[model samples]
Target: MAEKAIAALTEAQASEELARLAHELARADQAYHGDDAPVLSDAEYDRLKRRNAEIEARFPALRRDDSPSDRVGAAPSEGFAKVRHAIRMMSLSNAFSDEELQDFDKGVRRYLGLGADEPLSYTAEPKIDGLSLSLRYENGRLVQAATRGDGAVGENVTANALMIDDIPDRIDGAPDLLEVRGEVYMSHADFEALNLRQAEKSARTFANPRNAAAGSLRQLDPEVTRGRPLKYFAYSWGALSARLADTQMAAIERLSKLGFRTNPLTKVVEDVDAMLRHYAEIEAQRATLGYDIDGVVYKVNAIDLQDRLGFRSTTPRWAIAHKFPAELAWTWLDGIDVQVGRTGALSPVARLRPVTVGGVVVSNATLHNEDYIAGRDAKGEPIRDGKDIRVGDFVQVYRAGDVIPKIADVDLERRPKDAQPFEFPHLCPQCGSDAIREPGDSVRRCSDGLICPAQAVERLKHFVSRAAFDIDGLGAKQVEQFYADGWIAEPADIFTLEERFGSGMQQLKNREGWGEKSAENLFRSIRERRRIPLGRLIFALGIRHVGEQASLLLARTYGTWEAFETAMVDAALMEGPAWDAILAIDGVGRVLAQSLVATMNQDAERAVIDRLVALLEIEEAEAPYVADSPVANKTIVFTGTLERMTRAEAKARAEALGAKVSGSVSSKTDIVVAGPGAGSKEKKARDLGLTVLDEDAWLDLVGR
Candidate 1:
């Protein structure tokens, strides 16, 4: 049966579809990018994203804030230091069909106001199926390497990247500063050899070359990455002090000349027909290619043309990835199982009869939420034609560079007579806690957060994560082992490990996989993390809604841990100047504000905080300052439409110059940058006798 068209969907239906797409895509992004374990195949993920785009196009007002179209990738994984990209590493829009490719070309011509017969050229190259890496060099020497995390920020993997033979440590003729972007991949031969080694060691093997490359490159220890047969192919560039080339093909040649491996199949084509022909040629040779090639990526050849095309929020208009067809197969749905996540959300996983899809054996797939199994969305809107999945039913499965396969459709005709509708549990399976779905939430959450083993163990993992205390020797595996052994229970227990188990008969050295030296090293790592930054300490608490950014915001707001604690204690009443102050923060809303205050006010949580505080030396957040800058350490408020730059851009610029950007105009505001259509904030600023400047005047003052 044909699926319902986007034009045919009601406004409510479109909204519901958008919500479902957001949830699924967000989870998929986190799994694939963050954990390096993808649950949904790329093809299915793309289909849902395409549907979301079509619906948003038809009903513009229904576009969501967390829209899939506006996002690039998942946030950086937890166990790595984050590096903000100098220039955002944008994702390319995808084209699954030749017609879509044609639309891309036509869209480019339309944007540039060119005729159909306009002379234009494009570079078509094979899109490598591997992790995206950005290498930063200064003075022709390698300085940093990062993963394409959420585009804006990425994981710092400089040491790991330096170990790859294909990457150059230095290039004498390069610009003073340059950011080379490309793919880090493993060959088919290497992947198989790696799996053999894993089997010999009784370790889990990777699902594919992509996963192997990602897992290898993101290892905490650089020596692990050095042992992996990893290679890099430089195809693009990010931040650069000077232009390397004037055209896409020329840039690739320049990168190749600069001691970087460039794909041999990359070619400049004169027209859309030539591009399609090249894509076909590449597809034919894909099997013979030593590495994985997902599809052909096409980009405008001329640099000037690309600049003219510009970019959308997430993707560049000048380029598109023409993906290969997805692989599919039919299999039986053996059963359905529920698993609780760190946040206590009950996620359903489908157990399928082992079958081969895309040359990989698959047995499990994600069911997203209970609503997904029931064949409906959160609002009870019909999905998959209202065909609920049941045990012992034949289902169509698809695979596209993913570890977990996706069930595309269920065959009701083949459903077993004894199979019944699967009942989603009302209680947490791990702890027997009441699992209640909030009014506006999609998934049921366990009420007993503190006592639940699943949540507790996950929180311990987060506490030792890269952005938190980052105890070098204490990783997720060690945390789990210690927790299960009843040696550690809370964050405070980690500080007392040396005292409790260092000298006794049950000493850490006596444990399996631990030597005297290794145990001492672990204790040293723990001791080293005793003096932690304020932002990291806040993020380590595992409070809901207090993420890295919010933690930093709170740290900057309060300056010191003592100030933050005192303010939170005062704000426990939930109504007062203290609470109002938290609500007034630039980016923090009432939701986050309330979460921080409530967590600090809880007696159990407060005790935990006190215990950790007693053992650790928390550092104060240093005020940002720029020499001779007028707005240095001053508060500035932006009001109305700024024609020169976006609000985000303005705020970033202000922050860069050591000026604090406040959302609302207050008596503390030193300057107010107001543009046309300035409203209440601007009026309030003027009434308060604060300095006011137009966009041009503000720009001039900043010397932009």
Candidate 2:
């Protein structure tokens, strides 16, 4: 009786422990993947996962319903519309080691009841480090595109998808409804080019290609998406209305026939050994591939067999992703230096002996922050030489999935005997201003904002950026030339280009690479951009945290340049409900507001603004509708036909008089301005207890 009770208690206790462990593991996974900041190390997370797996195996009869061991990833994001896949595109289970790969292969063979003599064909392809998208075509025309959100419901990105060059507008011999799954990747060359351009323009550089591609695709404006260079390669498929072929190779052939560019490296192998050989070949030549690939993905060639094998909750039993070993190399850490950003964050960068890795010469790598430099190792000793990196110490650098090289380990034995630990400066190297590190942040920042020469040059470049002033023929080199020649110094100086060099224009025409035609083109381009859009003007001002999206939001909200300028100045001078009103703009946060105030208060900035106002024709400020006013403050949801005004003109006029014109209506909507053929927004506004106003009423309220 005692033994039976003990056994029962043990089983119940084991089950409870397993459930608790599973929850913890899932939360950790979410933190790692969703946040990109993992709380646990790889070893610690692996240990916890192994323990949970063991518990689940022991108490099979008492398994929890929501186990981390069972779940693949988080459910689909909520913001996007749901798209149920007819044929689910399952993720692959990963193997970090050759032993693990062998075990995975053995398990697959055993599960399929395959004998030693039985042949198994597999196809291996590169696992791209990019966002997974599913493109659906109906009767040869592209219809929908969705993201791989939780391997299920995905964000509808049809507008952005249309901009991708590789995605065919129409396909030949396609089914009524066919879904082709692929990776939207930014090539390494394009990534480098973009980063160079961003650096020249003093814009925020993306950490990696995957991030750049993802951010570009999520842009609200399809036009903005069209500007980014994005490419795609169809690797798999889902939701087929008509069958293509029996084998995976045949299906790929069919897709190619339908005008899709399938990866040419994909090949049918006779056995697992052949698959491994193909993976090795690919891995060996990965650097020359010109794109970032994290691993090799192998899947069974026969579609019918794959279906029979079925899938687990998140991964298919027939497919596995074998990751390459982290690309690591030893380099001599010669020295360390601090570089200041526009925001004044001082970052420690490791200066190393140049080494070629992934087809690129790497001479410098980010050290992250001081804490990372001084962090302790497994032996409870500081990782860096003498609590920080020394002038001459051998360091191991690693690049995983095209991630920026990071110092992995220090070879103290290889350290030069005379080498000394480097000292960090407390003053800004560029401006000699005192650098200060905030309480929580690891970075030390220069106090000089606009005054720092480096910062000023950077800000000036940002002013004439493509998304800002977009001065044609004024590339980075030209900007540098103008700055060096003392022809232009500030953002406002650009407006006085022709005036400053009116008589000397002939000299510009005679200058090397600047013929009469080029000079005329340059002047014409500058003149053409004088009457700039509100968003472009706002972005050109170089306000901190005000990116292209924020600039558009502020422009749409304010409607006119004067209104925005007045709001910014008012917010800068006063601190109360009026200041709160400025912050109330959808995307304007405290950091942005503070930066704006700081910029406005600077004498140098005020001079630039004054010069700009004098040189350029400033548009008259429009009256924006107020929320409290019966006519002025109403939340108007515009829809239908407007014969008199363009849609843009209508929205601008409505916003000018302090009216909030929303894209969609809610219970808070004051009026629905319907035009000739009022659509869904108009109908929804009426249903949501809001007043419906026609175009005549909208025009009358604006006094048009």
Candidate 3:
């Protein structure tokens, strides 16, 4: 076809052509960047690029800024706040072959007016797959933290940043203003643990460490962010008032002095060839590394030279990110199956034909939920197959840049006639209970709770988790064995194990896997856990919706087990407005409140609790300090911010001295700490003829 004829086409025809080109380009980009799999060869991309360029040259006005021909890569997302970077963060151009890399080196030398014989050094470090963040510290304290929104702007996440233990709050001998750029990442171990926890809670599990870090940082509630384990590794600088050392190695050393966590694998190389060698070394050990890294980032060692090279509209001339080729292969989805999680979430798993992707054997991939399988596109046709995934369907499996494998597409034509639509079971596969999907949720949960063996075992494991009891020598397997042997049925049984098993000591010693030393160790471990704090004890109870932090909050509020139990029973019996007030605590949701009441109402569980309480040496509840002592020995409710301390600290301090902290402002509420942002609780307190204290009053009463 003639160029003029193609250029002079009708707008409708031109648009259709552009749409086709866009789709082709997008697919190519997804394959190359997102999936690490290049569907189109480099020669193919070049041909498409040339054709796109010709069309754009012919129809100049029709081209968009986002056009594949003009754009270097994807634009940054807007989920975060925009920051105007003091120094623009630029992406690098890539080289696929050794020849291309050599040519690039030659061009660099030519641009720098240097001879081929002259020696040049470069720093090579792993390009982590994580969310980029800029941390700005002023006068030794962390002042601002932002996400890399665009190369220029980012989202402000100072509050959430405070939760990361690796990111220091203060650095010794730091400049007046320092802006350090780093990657917020999750370690492989932490990621796995988080996924396990998510499965237990029936929550959405993240696909990879990078996604997990990104999702955790973007949570609207800072309190929620506080619970996730995140780490930071300084990689580069955005803006620093103080000058860095002459070499990249020196700059990293300086960053370490400033208390920033720098990646230990960073090394200075003598040339691009050496840099490539470093890349190979890192790539070879990628599987053994604690975090996911997709490539190596190479930058000019000298800041002055970097400034001289300047930058393109999107990328710096001095730096390059050399990415490893993606591991991809076509695999068939042989069947669909469901796995019952600890929380009874029926996870649809695709059983795929064995294939290797990213150096790992990929047999099974998560299919998310049934809704995702059945959802339709704007065209009213199924996005993948006309029908939901069925047995014996030829489905295309994909392992994207993410670690989790997924079913990307299905070939319906190749599906066998005998194939049947997969039916999600209505009963828990592990426990045989009727699976119950909550009103607004898609996950089908087992309502068996502590009664179900699987759930009970999981709960017991959680009770002794690191954040909970942290009992030594009492691991999950031990707990399961003890439970299975009828040695321990309730939480109380654990405290009395040594005494109960003492008489059978000789028999236990003679049994396989039960030596005198092992029995002694178990007893020692149980004894060490006997004096656990109120928070740990409450968490070990495994109340639904009650996490470690929430358990601590309740412990601080009620001070003792007796007080907490009495308050819960009283709140359940309260009427109308009084009942609503009891449920208004920051962590006390309706679901938790209902679960508490239901559990308390169960005679079987209640009897166990009473027996446990009787056997244990219950400590006295701490009294809240009050100058006037008007509400002494009475329950009080606090809402909103307090000038004296955070709500958490205040609650903790209140219970320490002996005051019952109730969630709601009720007729029984003797006093209320009504600080800034006090909500209905304050009003309810007033209506009920209860005394309310402002920030100053609360501080005065607490004698702070």
lDDT of each: 0.84, 0.68, 0.66
Candidate 2 lDDT, tens digit per residue, 1-704? 11232233355345434533553555455433333333333333444455555555556544443455555434344345566665565667776667677776776666666766787787788888777888999888888898776455566788899999889988888778889998988988998898898899998677667767877776668897898889898877888887788888888888888877788888898876787888899999887998878778888888876764666646777888887766667888878887765556567778889865544345766665565576432223444443456768888876544333667777877878898756677888889998876543345678887677666666677676655677778866788677777777787777778877873488778778898878878888778777787777776776644545456667776778777777777777649655676555533555556666667667877777777766665454244436554567566677887777556556655654567666556665677888888878877876776888788876776676
**Candidate 3 TM-score, C-alpha based:** 0.48
Top-lDDT candidate index: 1
Instruction: Please provide TM-scores, in order, for all candidate models, with all chains considered together.
Output: 0.77, 0.51, 0.48
RMSD of each: 6.0, 17.6, 19.6
Off by over 4 Å in 1: 1-40, 43-125, 133-172, 176-179, 186-206, 212-231, 238-241, 246-249, 264-290, 295-327, 502-507, 573-580, 623-634, 645-660
Rank by lDDT, highest first: 1, 2, 3
Instruction: Estimate candidate 3's alpha-carbon lDDT, on a 0 to 1 scale.
Output: 0.66
The Cα RMSD in angstroms, rounded to one decimal, for candidate 1 relative to the true structure is: 6.0
What clash count does candidate 2 reach? 13
lDDT winner between candidates 1 and 3: 1
lDDT of candidate 1 over 341-449, digit per residue (tens): 6667787889999887764667888786787789876667777889888889899987766646667788898898998998999999999989998665667888888
In model 3, the runs with Cα more than 4 Å from the true position are 1-330, 333-364, 367-387, 391-409, 413-417, 431-433, 436-441, 445-451, 483-486, 503-514, 573-578, 611-704
